[model samples]
Target: MTSSFAPDSLVLNRKLPLWYQVSQSLRASILGRSPDASLRLPTEEQLAGHFGVSVLTMRQALKELEEEGLITRHRRRGTFIDPAARRASPVRLLGSIDAIVAQQSGEHTTILGHGPEPVPGDLAAYFPQCPQVVTYRRLRRDGENGEPTNWAHNTVRPEVAERIDLADLERWPMTKVLRDAVGVDIGRITDTVEARLADPVTAELLQVPLLSPILHYTGIAYDGAGQVVDVARIHYRGDRFAFSVTVEAR
Candidate 1:
């Protein structure tokens, strides 16, 4: 029913399953609509065309929505939004690093520790020329409740680290510190998010139970010259966080 849908605005991450990504983007759009908005959805063929995907892929995405009760498809009547969708909880979708930092601006930060340390094995590839990095650890707590929400371990190139003050770590996100304070012209940031069971260290830091589910976020930042400047790994309490991405039609 919507005539203004702009498919070109939908950015799909090739790293993830195309169908799953499409479904999530659609899910966000459906849930974002007002209760008074039209409930009818475009035909599968039309949607596939809009999304630049095969009809089969679009159908798979719609099936996901149907399974979640966000939409109902009647054989010949087309798909309509489920009434329950209006009552569904709103999701917070952060599309960029700045948005993410702004979301946590009110959180209180505690500096756990910081010192020169060996490059972590997983991050070795990002810093091929360096043997060591400045490791900074911090914990973030909700400003309202003072409950711990996430823990971050950030490794910075020694040169970049030298320009950062320890006091700045408590006040700003690393990305901001790197760009604003260290004068690094960050060109790109690649992020990977996954679910993992909390280990002893992470469990204690996040105040969660051992083996409890947690969200693992890994970020690799590159400077304008294409050199890796920072690598960050953060553990967030799954209960306290939800990662969402909005797919704008226009």
Candidate 2:
């Protein structure tokens, strides 16, 4: 490892199985210690001592990681992180939210619920011809540490809504899901991020305390033909995320 291979506090959560918690802790720890994917994990005996767990428990955690395809164990060489776990740069991710989420290790989205709903008047103005929309309400959590990160609500125009599969939404990012379902290319994405305190419902869904600070984001996407493709509102846990922008000097 770079400097340390110690497990984070994530490994101490007693609510989950010990091995699972250890696995999540290790997954998050990998990116820090092996930014280049060249580091080999410490042996099981050492890791067990470091984490205050038995060798068998450590092996179970390693097995969980292996099953997730995040690590490879060799008979003589020890365990190494899969090269693909390396995260992309921040500027690269700004091109598309979906692209960034896809590249994040142990990031996953679950559809808490979905149904037909009327498009809000402001969002509806973007689609004069569509009167109603289908909505998907989802929660995004860190796959590694099992922390709730965001609560997102997405509404699609009637035409494209009919083709969407909730399953696909869970598996793919929003942009790709829209493109594949509509068979059209996305031309533009516009979004704004602001800070706000979480409301009761939002706090409950995000598992944050009421009145906790949150990053509220809203966006609208369009197709090449200039038709509104989708509208979304997302509430992210402010403490868990950080945003950086690259400024160029003239």
Candidate 3:
């Protein structure tokens, strides 16, 4: 039988393999039904019986859905649909360093490497026509002598270059330097996040085995006229960092 999955279309359920068919059915539910943003999803056995599939096959389909970021599973709790995006726009802001750092109960930092480097083409694509960019690459440690938690690569416009001093960065974040020394008011920002296996360089820096998972967060800050003032990538230590969001109606 032909696969019945439709990207955004609902299913009427005809003749199809139970697991393959259920995958499509759930996809439709995620897009159309708009399940409660905070509600946990039903159990695997429950889902298997609900759709007439063996538990093992049901699991395979669920794994596929999780890779698509359609759902998440906790240790003991059942699987849950990812309702953050459908419920509301994700949180995009400039106060991330303070917002995250402050939440830690103890001192959680040790900055390593801060200097000027030409921004990558992918990141440069986000900027307005500009010559030369300065970027700060800091290896942040989460605790005193803790494993390196992230490689924070921050790229900024030339105008903001003077604010960064490698000699003093061991003491402060470049975000603060932009406001305190460079005189630019950070009014808006945007962040995009993804979870993936660590690349070779990141694997070594994070002290993780090859193919170990990592959370990557990329972000950009813009000027009032929509010029891209900064682009940054943060590779967070997965075991230590928890990326979460809350959704509400607009």
Candidate 4:
């Protein structure tokens, strides 16, 4: 490994179970010593070699780590370290800054952007024919270095923007802006979540290895009228996010 390895934290002489010892050492390297919070976890094969163990044994240790909420695995991407900032969710996250922030505590806000790109055909299905609104994109992260954690892209109708000041958004979250400015109280939301491979652009921005997996969410927002008003698509670093939801079984 690079100079980021915390070799001092590792003790080859430890009497702990082999798997346990190897797991702790790997965790320390991935989370403790990496220069960047966005650094991706090493491949399992690499870990196995580092510990001089069979891949199966290395996997067992990684499995335990995943169960402990320390790492997440993506279909196309390998395992990743989940950031500890997100709090539990109130309901299914349908892709809103407030909803995401409810599961997190830190400075969060949207940056106003100028763009009226025609809504993609896939996303257009979520809204009716109308004047496409200006969209906003925000990259959110916490702690020192401002390591970008996730990118949130939101499309809002002109009516909503007309009543809200873009300047205020830089300081306050989108929900607070809507509720306080436009008198819209968000009651609930619905969304679809999926695992996706990182395109070259996303990987570069996130400082993650290209081809790594990222969490993808695409959905629409409905006001009290139950009419969809906005459509959003967001991608998050898979290694930096772990999702847990409670579902009822009938």
Candidate 5:
């Protein structure tokens, strides 16, 4: 049977490892579909062709999916989507600032530590002219199962942080706290997303294996007057999250 997989939809990023990119694309497509035990995926050769990758690369991608329990392969029987895939419940990482804020509002949050600290040298560009920033570290878990999903480290201007109620951090996303409580006029937000290997600290906090692939997000929030207000560095467990984007043809 011919598979309905769309080759055009799979855009390859040459910078990243081919197998990893293909696997992530396939993972997203598979999860986006309705869970069907009888659904058969395209053959390895066909999928490789669709993704414009070598069969070996496709196999590697498929192997990763199998390890994650998202699919099962059988000799001479083709591959089928795992019925349990629905239970995986990967977070759909959206692009919009508002969407990003709304996505985390529903998650269960645990504050790890928050206090005044010097901004990291790497992030100094974002918080120009500021010697110190209020650092907030938090771990977010799935509301249903309490599974750790993301760890976020936020650095805010001391002045802005002072106006925010520490208690509110446990309940609302920082964007909301800054706007509503601190009265910062958020003019724009910039987000950069990338894939990185989990460091030792991140692995222990998120309870994932060291060096496992994870989603790294760096976000900068600017005030209406164009002053930077907050910089957030967040790491999401790869197995529990998938980044997605929507584009419209003008």
Candidate 6:
């Protein structure tokens, strides 16, 4: 018997396998549905019955949906659309470093390296009495294409550093990580943006040519009681991002 599953237009091919076709159709439906509508989808058995396929086929389609981050299947709670999937938009300056990262929920981060390092003379002004810190470097990439978009270097006090794990950095921003690890509440974040040509190491990490234009960011974050929590230097591909600000009339 011919497969009854409707073709998912997003896939751009009608002759694909039955499971692939059904998954495309279901994904398109969930994404196009109203934001307020029920985010859940039908059970595997019901879906299979509707498509004249076995439950295994339906499960295979659902697995694709889960892997694409379009929908999530709970052990007993059924499958539901991922809210973050729909909400991800191009990165924009909302507020704070953490806010910027959180806004683009679609991007993925990889920790390139992490280790303790001596505080630089310039950065030491922010930390004052602290002599050493731990540094963590990360590469942020496009979720769909896996293209490297930005790189960040984060430095924190040893106490706060000890509390952070490579896994924690993967899921949360360094700012939030500090708060969760040591109860550090950030009070102010100072940012300085500049334009510069990429260095050899940066070009390699960002996959851009040496001397490519780059946006350089230097940020210092302070805690509620005016203690330094962390400092960061972030480099973003110049073509991939824009900064926005607002000013009031004098």
TM-score of each: 0.62, 0.58, 0.55, 0.58, 0.72, 0.59
Q: Give the per-residue Cα lDDT of candidate 5 at 68.
A: 83
lDDT of 4 by residue, 1-250 (tens): 3343322234453444667656655654454444444545667887787777788888988887787677798867877767662422222453465664354233554463656666656666555685476677766666435766666677766667677777766665455566566776555456778867678977877776565557776656667777665556666666566455655575
Question: Residue by residue across 1-250, what tens digits does model 2's lDDT show?
Answer: 3453444454365655677657656765664342433557789998878777789999999998898787899998898778666442221225565654353222778888888877678776886876678888888777735877787788887778788888887776677777765575788777777867689989898886566557687777788888877887877765454345544575
Model 3 TM-score, 2 decimals: 0.55
Candidate with top TM-score is 5
Clashes of 5: 0
Q: Estimate, for each residue in 1-250, the C-alpha lDDT of model 6 and write its tens digit.
A: 2222232243224455777766755764554454456666778887787766689988998998898788888999988778765531233454665674464333688888998888978788877778789899888888735878788898888877776777877876676676665577778877777867689989999986566557787778888888887888888775455454545465
Ranking by TM-score: 5, 1, 6, 2, 4, 3
- Scored by lDDT, the top model is 5
- Once fitted onto the true fold, the runs of candidate 4 whose alpha carbons sit more than 4 angstroms away are 1-101, 104-112, 185-187, 248-250
Cα lDDT computed for each candidate against the true fold = 0.76, 0.70, 0.61, 0.61, 0.79, 0.71
lDDT of 1: 0.76
lDDT per residue (tens digit) for residues 128-162 in model 3: 47657777777767566875767777788877677
Q: Comparing 1 and 6 by lDDT, which wins? A: 1
Over 76-149, each residue of candidate 5 has an lDDT whose tens digit, in order, gives 99987786675234444455667868755647788899999888898888788888999999888878458788
Candidate 2 regions off by >4 Å? Answer: 1-93, 96-106, 248-250
Stretches of candidate 6 off by over 4 Å are 1-106, 248-250
Off by over 4 Å in 5: 1-38, 41-68, 72-79, 87-97, 248-250
The pairs that clash in candidate 5 are: none
Model with the higher lDDT, candidate 2 or 6: 6
